[model samples]
Target: MADEKIAKLVKRRSCMKSKLTVFGNYLHTLESCNELSSLQLLDLETRFNRFGSLYDDFDKLQCDIEMLSEEPDDEGEEREQFENQYYKLVAAARRLLGARPHQSSQLPDESVASCGDGRSGGFKSNCVRLPKINLPSFHGHYQNWLEFRDTYLSLIHLRSDIDNINKLHYLRASLKGSALLIIDNLDFKAENYEAAWNLLCSRYDNKRLLVNNHVHALFNVEHIKHESCSAIRHLIDVTNKNLRALSTLDQPTQYWDTLIIHMMAEKLDSVTHREWEEHRNTLNNPPSLEIFITFLSNKADLLETLQENKSKTKIHNKNSLDTIKNHYNQPTSTKYTQNTYLQYNTNKKHNNTYKKSLTCPMCNQNHFLFSCEAFRSLSIEERRQKAKDAKVCLNCLRPGHIETRCNLVPCKYCKKKHSTLLHMHEAETTVQPSLPVSNLDSFSSSTDVLDTTTPPIVLLSTALVRVVDSKGNVHTARVLLDNGSTANFVSEFLCES
Candidate 1:
């Protein structure tokens, strides 16, 4: 395992270092070449940093071809150099940007129109960077691959504002006539290819229709539905599709690791079958790795010998542990519980005194420290003590008194006590009977005779209102007002209003 890990690290390093070198060479070529314009240089550098150095050679060669094509009657020497540079650039592009085509369909026509409007930004515009193309000329940006990709997409959209159609035409013309456009990292959106492909297909008769292919179009998807490789159908011939995409590199590593771990665990299980209690009790301390491994190897040999012994036992009953002592050390049962621990014997008479004083009701474990159990799942003594402290009243089943003196019945007013009592005013038993109506003559005209005078009518008019309670029920009642009361009892509704 250690060797394998080392090998993997070394291989990863080698791949990265080689990538850096390839990019370094591409950068050198860009710097040494004198004929290229600075504006074009800036553009190439921007693209190089956005993608990777792998695309630099191809891009440079494309530049060289354009320069040569403009020369109507170029010198033989210059023409040869141009031809050589052109092929080199195409080869580099092919190497860096393999031919993985997009799989997803273009955005719907309505979506495209909406996005074309400034309001609904294009998918490319949403991105801040395009993933670096594998153009080895820009090695530094490779460290931040995702960021480079985001920035690249943003730049592409920004350039669309200047001369979108013309840029598209140039890219298409390059692909069709002289330049092989290698767009690597095909995992990007299909819209990117759609734009590039539209340009190429427009100039269909152009013999050098530069290829747009990937080594293998990856679908590293969160969900299978996002794998919209359907767009590839438009470009690739359906009958000969296998030629377009092929899996390279390797099968995923996780499957092998999982399989190895499971196999090791199964082997260990078969080789560690001693009775759990006996095995646990026998261990005075944690076994060293050497001791453990030796025990394992020995168990394996024993199991093999026991298999033979078992056949013999069918003919003659002689396969007991004692009978096979010389020939085998067969594993016993495999069950093991964490509570299995060693115990010491003490005199019953002395232990009895300790037991009476230390009986624990919670777990019914040992009576003293010396005789204590070692069950980890069971709470420690301190935790159990805290729990006992926090225990509820046994009779009331509330957090206070013991069963004998719980005092859980209703009070003198017949008000039942509760665990929580924010609405204690609603306690039914606390209500009192009304007083006798002896003072009514002071306020009323007469008990039997009717008084005709509208005499000093108090004219107390109050409002009744419906109130919504905490549980969302509406209740209605007339609120009273009295001048003689010590304090005003304002209804909650009136106060709120």
Candidate 2:
């Protein structure tokens, strides 16, 4: 019986060590797993719950310590005190476990070491922590997604430590299996985006790694800057030449121009080639991919009716407004199909599944998206109520208060509301009526204005004339305009007289 008791104690201690070993190991390995998707981390955690015993052992130890404290004997008193202190530790251990559950599947092969020593603020080789991301696929993915992704990828690739690299890769592989890290901010200035792309693409000697990372570049279809257009064209040309370069990227590697045109129709529903021409020609501006796609897609819908006219395959493939989207996402049988239509479908039905990639804040679905009708109505109604609650301006229709707080002032001449008196009274008609005749006596309309040809000769007196140089030096001379001699003379005052 004594041997059995000791063996049980030994076994519990070993279990405690193993659990701590597993938990600590995970935290250490996962610290660098920023590149992995949330789903992948969850999968790892599901597996770790099977072998980690830190929590249970801590609980058992605490119970034993508490039971000893209940005894009144002197020997039990010391044991009880130790047990009480140990119970506090057990409580702490339980709390920690509750907060960070086992998130690793198989302890990442023990080959990958944990990050930093716990003393140095880094956990020991065995320290591991489970990850927790509530909205894994599509949360807070505004314009900075690409910048974040590239920065993360760079950190992983540049890491010199092999163990760190392995941990990173394992985490990344798990993430890629579950999440599509769609880059949102690719619409930045072309130079900046290109710079980021160059950095990410630099380490790409192998093509498969690039695709596995799911590097998707999102670019705006419309840009007014000439330099930006030129850069885009150049990028599109490069993509054309190296289609393989984009084979692995999550976004379609089609020419940017083509993609822009497609996305333009998708985002705007009432566009036409003629309208596109007007925007391109008049504004020297291209429509955004979203807007262009929306318009073209609409046009395609109209053209489908005029089918006596032979339609291009691109036109025929345009999705109808009322078409069922159920099968629209299934992976195509071949790469050609995938390339032609860059969409995929899954069987799983998540409540807010549409929120998986691009989410609609209104209904929170993956398909209808944030711009969908259901969400748009909700947004509009909410905005209207908010404006009503805040007492929006009646005239300007702006939010955040009434017209009393408006900076607008009444214009004196036009009797219209303006921001300032200076803006109102600076009118030409106001200037004409306000001028004093005395102020005009010495100032000739012609002389008051600048004459670049020659500095105006200032008649100091009837005989003396002066001119100022560019350096503001005044040169005065005596001159006579004499009718008697029929000559003009430049001389000293005495000679002139």
Candidate 3:
């Protein structure tokens, strides 16, 4: 039984060394392929798993050799040979596990030799832990399927560290909404993560369906008038999106390029289309889809800039015009000066006509009584005293005896014997005194004299005159000076004296 055990141990050690050699060669080949195909990735994963199994077998063999070395009956030479074989096995196992042959001087002696068992202290050599992969999230949308599939498979499907059993959990955690629902409905006991992934692909990864949807979306893009920049950006985004989808579907670049260019051209307005055609005509070679998209983007930017500049210029011009109009419409002081001069001339002419028919009482000159410089220069009280001494009737402002003897009638408004100038209240009614037909004709003729022998008329002007009696007594009498009187006559009492 001991020989058989030794034979089994030796055979297992040989197998582990041979497996390690094969694994090393395989790892070299994998590293050589700069980009690994899907088949190569699967092969690599299989090789890594095989290497792990071999490592477990090697660990058991090392334990068996250690057990064999403890047997007392074994010679020192035989024990040294077993130790040598065990060390060789350890070296082979380390190479298979991709561990560096050299030990760091910084690591302690126990840690460096820990791999003699199937562990590094508490850590197991058989359990190869790989870095956890963070899967890309998916919302089950058809558009996101392509990207999600690429990331999901790259991180999970080709990795050896993640077991098939734990794949379902990672897959579930990486999805949400409709995607989660699709996986949740699967029979948990029977269906694996692969089956769930297959279901997702069948539903969302229909290449022909995706291509058609993307093509339809690209064709239907429209440019908004006010949102030209956003519209152009959206157009480029959709174009690139569909192009990438087509490329993923293995559609020919030339075919999809022509199709996309035509679709984009159709979506453009007449002006932009004409401009695109002009640009195309100018190019010696037919413009590629990428070049066309770039040109359109540039054109959109230029249009937006031009529109902004034009709006600013229009506003500036409008403001300038308004300012000019305001400047033109404003009244000038020169116009006010001319108006003042015309008003002063008109008032002077009116004053000259008034002074032609009047005489100053103090100077007996052909000027207004108030226009006499001597009288005007006097104080208010002194002027009043001079007017009183000259027998100026204060009521009618005429040269005569005092106001009591003056024959001035009361105001027509108040019907009281007072000056109309003294009447304060607004007149409720007015009556024009009726003049005789003879007086009316005489006044109308312009050359006829005014009658003096009429009853005292309200608000009419009157004056006082000095008279001499037969006894040589001086008496004052009130008399009305009427321009309409044809002949003047004294009273009967005065005529008899």
Candidate 4:
């Protein structure tokens, strides 16, 4: 790898100093002979073109020498001299050739766009610095080589003004993984740039490898499980990109339209596949790749349109409902409020009359059997007998129904089809017959021992709380408030829901 950096640093000055002497000789000949024959002009242009090929060996050899580590004392003068001759050589060729100029690296920086205003030779007024174009990166992937090659050639390698050092900097920066390692051992000298660049190109620029990579990519296109606008677009984009790459590889993808379509269609959702089949039947000629892609694009657009309209309809309905609710919920006029008050009182009076008519079967009290003090005072057996005699629900003590047909909840304690007050407690435990002292150990071995090491019983506070569900229906549920608990919890029924 070259010991390169991305800054505009001038390194390996001694190499250029040695090359300057040779470049100066050419300049001397051009300037010394003002007029030259066709042969002489040809020689000058040919030499200029040759030097521009960037095949110099001196930069590599000279940079490795310890003596050339620092530039010569007259490095400034030498560089200035080189720059002057560089432009002079270009001018001399152009002046002699009259109309045709021999191109070398690039034309003397004249044709290159500058960030400065011509008059000031500085940055132009009102200029906005645009973000630099990010170089395409490569990581030894055969599929990514062509893109990186084209981009690097256009931006760095082919540019004449950027020195070999800067080109090496850019090449190194753009590479990663195995690609970077190939050129990573080279020194950061101007001459090593070409060698590093060549190593990367030779390794990655394999036509056969690139073809295989893209072919595999095409075969591995993701399968869409369900039809949606974005899913269809993704399927279409991936198919086209891979096919385009394969076409560039001379795979005859154009002639393989039917085969390609069949392969790609299998990756589509069932609905889209059926649609493509039905649509292709209407075509007069055999279905082509372009036609298939166009069909998918159109379907994607239709799905998008449908989704947008659906969203708009839902929004409109929601707004209309909100507007109607607002109008109804607005404050009523005084007369309307008076009428509402009278209606509420009338409903209250009607409810009181209904309750007054519920005469208790026991003691003829003006209350339901369950609410009556006399009825509650009865023992469980008596209550059961009275409910049976009255033909009322044993679970709710309501008239005209049996406990089996009643919809009321069962007893909270015993979970039986009867009111909790009427549930008979289990018979008091009876002591087991005293085991013989000799058989105590045998008896203990036959029975499972109680787990004395069980977790301590925590005393948690609870309250009957009313909570509204997703449907806005209020439910009365008991909630435990335990400060020591790390998380809030709900019943299994709520969690599943």
Candidate 5:
């Protein structure tokens, strides 16, 4: 009798479970609908009322099965499964009917929805505490779908507290380009969220294509052209990312050490590769992938450290150019007296001290012999003797450089490069005593004496000529023309001018 009752109750439970699945399907169809028709609403209400009644019936069946069934464990699990499906369908139907349960609001400090393991009773907390959501974006790239999907599922899709319409909003916000076009025409309503989501998932959820793309990326990582920290870091990062992605695909990566090492080694620039080879040879055992990766990481660190130190060295030990510029950039009053004196002397022909090399021969003063009044008072013979005694340049009468290299103005006394005080004046020629005039007459008569009968002299006033020198300096010069004289002479005043 007990077995018979148990069998009958078990059969009823199975029928109820089947009925619940049909209702679940109906609710799902309703949930997917963008708008409910009047008839659909009527049917939904009627079904919910009936399903609402089944809750009690299901409770009663659980109690009866627990009491009558011999195998409590199996029946208990089946009963729980049926109850879970029953709750979801009921909750969904009621929600669609605009009758969400408010029992959750009654627990002020209620335990959080235990969805940490990714399985939940589809629990939603009133005023749910959410983490700071930083949404990920997509642009219809196969390479990006996996990351976007995983992140969106965690941050938005799996969040039960957000409604389908809001989740749809997040989805739309995150999408662009062809990815967005997949669902762009859909209406922004709760019913359309699932359809839009499904379209996106269906298009981008191709695992075979993803695997091929990631694998291609693994082999196609950009080659390192130089041994730099950033480039090495990029190479390491790209390889690790692709390898991790391959590992996620359940690819045989554990045995890929030698193959990956060979491929990655070929990608390294010559210097880095040579260093890596040296490191590899130093190891007694054939290095594993971890060891190889560690070598690259350490290399990158050392390179980065060296680059930083080089930059610091440049910053600390500045060049002399700026210092020299600053030194010259100062105003005359601010500079040392010697610099000012040199600059001032460049503009004017005369200098106060002339130079350190200049020293008067007679008094040993810091002036040229020509510039000294006491030296100027001496005769040319005395000045020449003084200059010879001092071993100075008799031309400029200055020390240290010869007459050929002298830079002073020419002597005003003679139009020569030597100092005026050292210039030698010429003596006027005598009448040759007229060859004792009578003898000259006899000699001139013998040679038919062509005007060797010296012409009678006449005193002529000094003639002045306006002369312009090569330096553009114009001078009023006294010109004396004498047929008897073989040379022309200019006065000291004209030479100085």
Candidate 6:
């Protein structure tokens, strides 16, 4: 068995030597040809294939020799000779194949599988195939360097097919803008992929600068308007963008919830701010950024709903008020003049009665003797004149009393034992002639024939009146007399009694 193993190793070594010789001759022939034909190219391709196959065999043989050698002291010289020969042949093959020194060490998948100890020559069944990753493209921004480098190294670096030579292509393809300029300055003929990758790292993989830039960007996000849905969406998008950038910088984001929530909250309107405050108070634990964002979204939805409802309510109220005004103010055709006149009279009568009811001395309604909005709204001089005309006492400004026997203090200006306003009243009375009061009995007899064409004069006064009921009962009542009234009004309580 020992002799057979020795003969097998010798035969394999001789076969490899012969193949190398043939490959060398083919290379010589190709180099000598000025211009290659299709046949020559085909022969070159075949020679390359053969050379690859021989290299795989030599690799296997090298592994076998190391395993079979018991001690370096005994078999070291022979093993060294074989290893030198193998390396020389491999170098020559690489030169012929136009492969760099770094590329020669990488084994293709087909070669690795074929050399494995299995009849089917497949990969180890126990091997776990990693899922392929599609890395995001880098455009020379220093901000993106860390992510791009990490993803590229983790995914592409482990692949056997992407050797250092192929890595050059990938690195160039991945770069853009200033990154391309960086590679352009390097002597690519001398620099390998690792050297170029290290150069890129040295320039852009500054953890401190990157962290500062990302943090600054996060803090300096633009203020968002809170008018529309698009504005709110834009705010969320800007916040998410900054957070994602920070995360990419490998900064811990778990502690950034407060900062992010504050930044987002600053963009809210008054209503949304109140909503956030209420929601935040109800939380047992401090709210996260995501929870705060959800609150804003819900608040925005509610605000939109309320705005729509308020608009609808305003429109409905406006339409109802307009309808009521039109029904009350619009007149009918000329053919119904009598009906219109009668309606006018009825309305006038009702309005007069309403005015009288509202004009109690103590209440602030239309044109009362005291404490009314209309009276207060009048100018000072108008108020004074109105008080004098109504025979209201200047001290208390109440009716049914003259300035003398008022029992109030003397005037401060004239030092007379009268109300303060009595001086102004006397001056005005002196300037204008006073009308003499006609006898009530003579005036009533003269005005016995009432004129229907003219509006009756309204006289407001206090009078003693007799009230008679259907049962022939008579009662004396002190009443407010209004002469303009066409019909007598009896109280419902009195009629019921």
Q: Which residue window of length 10 is worst by lDDT in model 6?
A: 426-435
- Give the root-mean-square deviation of each candidate in angstroms: 36.5, 31.0, 30.0, 24.7, 27.1, 26.1
Clashes of 6: 0
Candidate 4 lDDT by residue in tens digits, 223-276: 889889998888777777777777777788778888888888999999999998
lDDT per residue for candidate 6 within 26-141, as digits (tens), equals 66676676665655554554555456566667667756665665654544565566567655655543343332112222223223222223333222323332443444578877
Name the regions of candidate 4 deviating beyond 4 angstroms.
Answer: 1-131, 317-497
Taking all chains together, the TM-score of candidate 2 against the true structure is 0.20
Tell me the TM-score of each prediction against the true structure. 0.16, 0.20, 0.36, 0.43, 0.42, 0.35
Q: Tens-digit lDDT track for model 2 on 139-253?
A: 3232233344544444443433334435334323423311323222333343344443343344333345544433333233343232222333444433333334354244465
Q: Score residue 414 of candidate 3 by CA lDDT.
A: 62
Better candidate by TM-score, 2 or 6: 6
Q: Lowest-lDDT window of 10 residues in candidate 3?
A: 102-111
User: How much is the lDDT of residue 321 in candidate 1?
Assistant: 38
Model 3 regions lying over 4 Å from their true place: 1-134, 187-191, 269-271, 300-497
Q: Is candidate 1 or candidate 5 better by lDDT?
A: 5
Cα lDDT for residue 7, model 3?
79
Runs in model 6 lying further than 4 Å from the true structure: 1-135, 189-191, 227-252, 297-497
lDDT (10s digit) by residue, model 5, range 1-497: 99888889888887887788888888889889887775776577567656767768878987998987778898788877877787777667656654322122111122322222123323332323344445788999888787788888877777666788778888899999999999999988999998998999899887788789887887888788887999888888888887777677688888989988998899899999999999889999888999999999999999999999999888665555456556677666346645655655643433333454566767777776768887766766777787788777667676665576556688775668777666554544542222234333433333332222232443322455689988998876444444434444443444566
Full-model lDDT, candidate 2: 0.40
lDDT string for model 1 (1-497, tens) is 64565455445534544554565577556556555554544444344444344445434544444344434354345435534654454444332322112112211111222112243322222223323332112222212222333343443424434254443333333232132343332224434655554443353322122112221111111221211123222112221231222111132322333342222223233224332224535878754333443444554466566767777887565445346553444343211111121111223333464445554334455442222343222333443343345453323323323444444453322344422111122223332332124433332332123212112332333445697767777777454443323344433443343
Error of 4 at 398 (Å): 25
lDDT of 2 at 496: 31
Say which candidate scores most in lDDT: 5
- The better candidate by TM-score, 1 or 2, is 2
Candidate 1 local Cα displacement, residue 302, angstroms = 80
> Rank by TM-score, descending?
4, 5, 3, 6, 2, 1
Candidate 1 segments whose C-alpha is farther than 4 A from its true place:
38-43, 50-161, 164-497
Against the reference, the lDDT scores of all candidates come to 0.36, 0.40, 0.62, 0.67, 0.71, 0.60
